[model samples]
Target: MGHPTPAAVWIWMFPLLLLESRAGHLGAQETEMLEGQECRPHEQPWPTALFQGVQLVCGDVLIDDNGVPTAVHCKKLKYTVRLGDHSLQNKDGSEQETAVAQSLPHPCYNSSNKDHNRDLMLIPRDRASLGPQVKPIHLADHCPQVGQKGTISSWSCVTSPQENFPDTLNCTEVKIIPQKQSEDAYPGQVTDSMVCANESSGADPCQGDSRGSLVCGGVLQGITSWESDLYGRPERSGIYINICHYLDWTKKTMGSKG
Candidate 1:
């Protein structure tokens, strides 16, 4: 569903939990749509697996004078992802839900390197409190092995004018392009810490899907960031911030006190 107007985040996906509409009608619709759907969680291919919903950003998140993304910066990690059930108010008789992310951003991130690409961060939450429908995914250290396949998942709003909530969650498959990790290349210098993926041809990610996850091996590996715009044409390439390099940083940042 669309986020309330004026708060449009070019790449942000609205969690079903925060929809403006009531619970019963939307919940029923979601259930019916998901019925018999072939898509399963974390089963998608690489590169695409790196797409994840970026959450809980702070005011310090900057944009350049030209409107290009300057960084994936945030002042805190109060942002969260909801799984299994989509209500801010925990339901009665509902299974105990868990908030698995217990981490934060790397302290050394500079907000000027368009290529640093080190913006979003995550942490493993306590799984012992997890509900039946909620669980964590795996993270990969590099781009998928040669010819690896991945998928990009999002609760993309398909409805028009984006009233409080969109009608459904949308998913599509994309392939991970094979590239080398290097220190002097465009995405190379950060390749060790980030990964990239795309559809072979014709297919591409869209607006309102930014910060969505690109998952692989059941773990979160990358974050959807910027994409190439050929001026008036659809986006050609999508960028993501690699998570592996900052895994340690996440732990350290969240562990610090102000």
Candidate 2:
């Protein structure tokens, strides 16, 4: 499955449509072996549901001081973080929900452009506790190499424009695409703060996968941001907000808020 189109396009396509919308480093061979591995229940614990009121539009979880990280575009909601759950429809004892007290999108975030610069936001949770099944993912200390492999997980739609989100969490492997290659595919859209990835076999993050994490070598490298188009085209690569590029800003924001 490939990622779906952006919500902006989905709305025009279907006026009646409802809204919605990683692992460690290893040898090259070892990395290839881990691709597309389905995460066990709460296996990747840091991935929490980012909700806008009642709708799940992105994935988020704790960073520090009860702060959660997600895409800046996701700031448009009265957000909540749902932790420790694999299935959204069926919540077990492990699931915990926390209200967001504050949301701080990056100061340079610009929604009108496709560049996706500083496309990140931090949400402070109210009285949330960290447990075994709910934890924070480490942010990457450096940027990923162009060919490095990474992992992404989400409960978002598997099929584009279809709302076929899985009951359980899903994951896929992706290889980083070089800036030149990404620019060739996206044409003037890939910015320094953005990264691109795609699977040769055609799996991708769609509409519902926004704000999800891109983990590389046990650290978060990116945030699911946007795609080339609204339709799911396997050949088209997906764009992400490069976490490494904004580490200083992230730390400053989180620190200042506290």
Candidate 3:
């Protein structure tokens, strides 16, 4: 799973997005964590690493054991879930790595169709243990307001022509903006389920940075979905699936674990 790239148009390209059409670019998106500083060890206890076996696929949120795994991009393949990981290359001994028994993708997530909403999933494992360095975050109850400040945690590292997928976590500050920007940038692809944001501290999101958390007012409000290249067009904004819009679905879907 990775950030969406230049489509001549805008797209919320799959990091864990469930589209075979989108999976082809996963290798390119895996290049680096976008421009940002390193996150303190375990500071982002809610993020989990998703791997198609040994290879890293994307980063997801750990809301208890009910982590938000997005997309059925590879519907046939299962993922290895790793939590409490500060460094991907070097384990700090606080990591909880396990294989999930099953991944419950949103029943409505058929990205092959005109549907891109409901991309998140509730993953369960036979034995999933939480730790001091691994914890759950509560999803924001309300939609994010325009101009609201938030923090985006990313593992992507993209500094212009240089690209390196850093082992450590990274985070940057962001702000919610009007959806009109999304509409202007992405055209017909923008949906009400999605919200828009712009970089306030670091550079705009890139590959290896999406599908992570967008926390506002201290709650998980959204997930990184896509962005247009703002290198020249600074008016363009990144898109995130507003968690508040899907709160009912997530809770009901997660059921007892929620």
The most accurate candidate by TM-score is 2
Scored by CA lDDT, what does every candidate get? 0.39, 0.73, 0.68
**Candidate 1 Cα misplacement greater than 4 A, ranges:** 1-81, 85-103, 112-116, 123-128, 141-143, 157-167, 180-192, 207-209, 230-235, 250-258
Residue-level error in angstroms, candidate 1, position 83: 3.1
lDDT of 2 by residue, 9-50 (tens): 776766443322112333433423323445788878888887
The alpha-carbon deviation from the true structure for residue 210 of candidate 3, after best TM-score superposition, in angstroms, is 3.4
Expressed as tens digits, the lDDT of each residue in 1-258 for candidate 1 is 855665455234455535645677787655333111224432332111111234322111101110111124422334432333222233434323233234444455566664555666433333323333434345454545534555545443222222122222335465555444222233343344556565533233343235245555555555665444322222243455665655555435434421
| TM match of model 2 to true structure | 0.79
Q: In model 2, where do residues sit more than 4 Å from their true spots?
A: 1-38, 111-115, 160-163, 207-211, 230-235
Global local distance difference test of model 3 = 0.68
Worst 10 residues of 2 by lDDT: 17-26
Which regions of candidate 3 fall more than 4 Å away from where they truly are? Answer: 1-35, 74-76, 126-128, 161-163, 200-202, 207-211, 256-258
lDDT tens digits, residues 168-236, model 3?
777777788888877877778779988878774335566324536688877888776665555435666
Task: Please give the lDDT score at residue 255 for candidate 3.
Answer: 73
